[model samples]
Target: MGDQFPPDVIYEIFSRLPIKSLARFRCVCKSWLKYINHPYLQTIHRFKEEPTPIIFQLVPSANSNKNSKLCKISVLRVNQLGTITIEKDHVLDVPYKGWSHQTPVLGSCNGLTLVLYEKTPWHGTLLTLINPVTKQRHDLPPVKLRDTEWDCPSSLQAAGIGFDDSTNTLTTVFVLCKESFWSPAGINPPLCTMVHRLGMSSWREMPQTPALPICDEGVFAHGRLHWLSNSDGFHSANDGRKVVWFDVKMEEFGLTDAPKGGQYGQLVDLNGEVGFAYKDDGIHIELWVLKREEWVLRCRFDLDRPRHIDVVVCGCWNDDGDILLTSNGGKKRLFVYTLKTDDLKEVKLDGRCEAYIRMHRSSLFSIRGQNYK
Candidate 1:
């Protein structure tokens, strides 16, 4: 009765196991490879209570020593109310061959995170992606840099990751600017735009690039990579921030005017739609959803005297429709604000607040009209 455990039965049982265990079970049989990587199983892997990604902070040595860690990250566990009850669980070993300054993380999509590793004087820099759950780290090919060319930075510039729905594969995108040493039009900023797909052999440079230079890392949403850009460089007095996006399916770069507001803002997912959350650096805060290149104001709040702390809109916590806000207090005072009920909670975790926070968007919608085991 070996056939009693039919292929369908085995898949049902295997898909429900923890992601780490399911990854190991893939080696139980060569045929399991196709099943474990199946779209359905991958979606199921994301539904776990974990994945409220906190910054894995790496503090450098204060002794002014020559050698120090680039950065440390935090491991967080979810509490009963689905808040981040920060705890140390795993240490991510990043494979880089340079100083602690070389390991600036770009961002995280799904369960994967992209970290930039600077190469030795012999090598340039490598964009590496690591899956914290599976502990599978993949490094992209080294980016070639010219001796006289100024270095193109990734952290403050632009770095992002997203999924290509067409290929059903996750792709990490990196944009590097080539310095125009001579004339204004001599070189194109963000001249080198590259994409590295998971399980791929090498990186692929794109033919087109964004016109404006990216101000920071890309925020992935709606199957696209979005970043705030400065058309006139960061020094311009009227440095009107614009939203630049790369369509994974079309492989095209485009830009639009960001919602008119303050500099303290971020792009977050609003009920499966592209959302913009901003604070005026005062008591006023606004939330808007993208509606055909225009923004529709969804929510606005004005905090009172003592309650009006610098709040950063992170994302919607759960199905309760409460917006999550992290007060910009020092590391010692980690403030959490729930918008719906005007409730404030202090997250006194051991870990520092990560620069980039990614939401978990898991669904089994991809399995429709597909063949399965």
Candidate 2:
């Protein structure tokens, strides 16, 4: 008999193996290595498997000294099945002294983090893309919007990072504008947005959108960068809540309208799909999914009255997904939701301080279906 089994049966078996095992099995033979590293294998790995859970450190109030010194970084592998563990307390390490409060931990792509730091004096803010796990950091130079215009001390800036697998390069994009010029004045500010590709020493100005309220959170997924827009109240004529997506490959911005019937919810990725959660009548928490240009309500869970749990949606897949929601109002207790069974399980963590969880890479593997087994 030939050394190969049916390709369909091989895929079925491989789809169930964890990424670590698959990584080791890549050296089984030349054919095995070739099959595992194939582009098709990477595609299946990217979309088929469940990612490890990571936490985004949400520091307590600025007045709390005990928590102020803590570095707000993302923690991975807090929850998983057997044979997986997260030994490190924090994923990324910042060497700077003192705390940069609310510095904004943007999304992480390809083992790197897009962090925004506020510095003093002429350079008001610094945008950095660092590989926390690898300790490799790239600091982007200051972006000039106009020939004479410089960064304003009072203005707030937001940034995001995305990696192009095709080119194996990372890109950082920043949007800076006057803090007070958000309104539709007769003369709007010039060059409100700028983008900088890696290895370039300077920033390039880009066309600005029509003054939408910027979001506080940013994430990168599927080769694009996304952020929530609070432009609902920008102009009396415009709707209030919208989500904006910036395509890193194409360098364009597009808006995805919010669900028709929700208020005060956060946007997150659930198994690859864009997910949202909102508290309805303070009694029920509803999770919604956006797929193929339609918003569908997926699951709902009842919350105890006046408990005020902080819910943060992470990522999803088809009918099942994951959510990291804090139950104790102090960020001490965290719970994960499995949409398949609509079950909410409290994540038992070893650390006492508040922790953050994010979704890492996923893949597929087949052991017994092939000749190696």
Candidate 3:
């Protein structure tokens, strides 16, 4: 090879670096900045073999002053040697009304999280795309449908963020349920499925979407957003009320069977595979992984044991193939468990707070589908 490094070699190097570092390098020179917008760069960054870190959001306790708009966002990672460490923990001042609670974390994609802040009484909800690592932020415009959420107040909304591979764009999705809105002719509560593309200034309504509400915001995995249908079933995917997924690239929805005997399950991204954790009994937690579209028994952990008492899964530390968990109802502590070694490590949080998770991907070069960052 010539003195100039092979382009493929350079691509490999960039793919492995955290996106936050890549964002800084984009300012080095014009020649290097050109690659930020290169279409192939996204593919390399996304497909590279790397473990994603888990992000935890800690909010103030109910006893604390609710007027405070500040909260803490922490990044947790497990090194190759199986050591769990806090990569970062910093305070973020969320400048929105009633953001201290009921804050909608609409999933994390490309290291960016889409947040929905709703006014009390649940009106005038708006969105913001934030990269906790880069500290770069974008406030999304207000979303409107025939019946804006304010028009009909309800407790149900399914919102999330995902990457659209076909167009190399990030997407935001929101679905309001069981609310009536004023139409030109009459008041009706339409199946309001809203989508906002990264670069777009407006949110578009998607009709024909199922009217059922999703149980959680949704988890991104297998190139799609997956969530449980608010339908009754007994741990059987064959029940038809199993799992629902939205494919970002194709902008389509698909249904598949859920794990057999699954109950009180939470959808999760176990490494790159889609999986979930559920209480098998009072003492143990059952985890199931989906490989080749087939459900496989991953592993089980004891939650009632003295060491694991009152523990609940928060997310996965995919790097070390470990599960991230929280203990105590107030989410006072975090723990990392190795599936292979059965090792458990506890991470202490100074105070009790609510916990939310986001996966850390290395696509920091692009945010909101813009290359200038």
Candidate 4:
């Protein structure tokens, strides 16, 4: 069979398959394993659209009764009709023993997921990047603070990972802010933005953009990391702009337009474009996708469920128009909203203390590759 098909054709076929199938096919032969692990194949796999039904959930150690430092990841599969089945589960144990803080945020970028551990007032922050498919993890040292004299409780506010097109490498951006005692006075304590290349041992500090208060996690799309600006005053009365974005390629921060008349919503990656989905009343959810710097109303449908305080879009779009979402206030269940039929169904993941999930497509991209750093 190998002799019948050219190497390029075989590589293309392998690249088109799902990550799980690719993993199994690697054991077929040494040549196939080499092809699967090749950087070219990995890059192709990363760029190609994978409408896989796989979902990745990051459960903090605090969420479970266990007291281990390992990060547990649950892999779930959803059928076209929105039925979820637990495919497998695994834990990532960081070999470094410097810190044991609980994990809080899980961000995805170019086939890799970045996990940020909750930072204590006395300890520094530790970040671990893991490829769940490959079971490979890389730990980054504690973030270096510019001003060590600030006695306030400093913590990670928001974090995200993106690809730097200019450098042809992966970059992560996170915001750290010192706690302010005078909340009534509306005094925002200084914030420090940190940037780190994939293979770097240390993080470099980026100048703070005060107008954009990144209080939420970032959604990576179109070569930039975007967040819903926490500051309401930054939005114009007429323009309705609310998003603060950082360019991974240019390494700059800027503002963008959000959906007009939107009361509250979260930023999501609709395939490769920026998407915003907000609740209209209680069960009515409206989806707006960004195209050519304009917000286009994609669709609006009722969730057919009880009212939720917050609606978090899974951002994983399938060919069948199935949208997965989770509520900020609920029983920690998954709501599959089908746009075609305007039906919503709930799937209960038993014993899930936290609903930290992201649409994941695994790849064989090596974390310790020579191209990094």
Q: lDDT per prediction?
A: 0.61, 0.57, 0.63, 0.66
> Of models 3 and 4, which has the larger lDDT?
4
How well is each residue in 220-241 modelled by candidate 2, as lDDT tens digits?
Answer: 6676666776545443323546
Better of 1 and 3 by TM-score: 3
lDDT of 1 by residue, 1-373 (tens): 1246777776677667776676566667766766776766665555454335345454544536545444444445556556646555554655333444333667656666777655443455676766665556666667654552555333225678787766777777777665532235433344568776665666777888887776556777778888866545343435556788998778899987777753557777543466788766577677887787787887777644355466666666655545656665454344445656766566656555533344443332221222322
Taking all chains together, each candidate's TM-score versus the true structure is 0.75, 0.69, 0.80, 0.81
Candidate 1's displacement at residue 311, Å, is 4.2
The candidate that wins on lDDT is 4
Higher-scoring candidate on lDDT, 2 or 3: 3
How displaced is residue 154 in candidate 1, in Å? 7.6
Clashes in predicted model 4: 0
Compute the lDDT of residue 156 as modeled in candidate 4.
57
Which runs of model 3 end up more than 4 angstroms from their true locations? 1-6, 47-68, 77-88, 99-103, 120-123, 148-155, 178-190, 232-241, 306-310, 350-354, 368-373
Residue-level lDDT tens digits of model 3 in 249-347: 777887877786674577776665677777767677788887777788878766535655666665666655678776644545677778789867676
Estimate, for each residue in 1-373, the C-alpha lDDT of model 4 and write its tens digit. Answer: 4778998898898888888677678779988878887867877787465544333334334434343343456556434345553444544444222233323454777777787643444556677887766677787666747546542234556788888755567788877775432233344546678888877767888765535566656788888888877655543556554788888877888887688777577777666667898886777878998777788998888776756446678866465557778766434566777677777777655455353567765556657654434
Model 2 TM-score, 2 decimals: 0.69
Candidate 2 ranges with C-alpha deviation above 4 Å: 1-44, 47-49, 56-92, 96-103, 132-136, 142-154, 164-168, 179-191, 221-223, 235-240, 316-320, 327-329, 355-357, 362-373
Per-prediction CA RMSD (Å): 5.7, 7.8, 5.3, 4.3
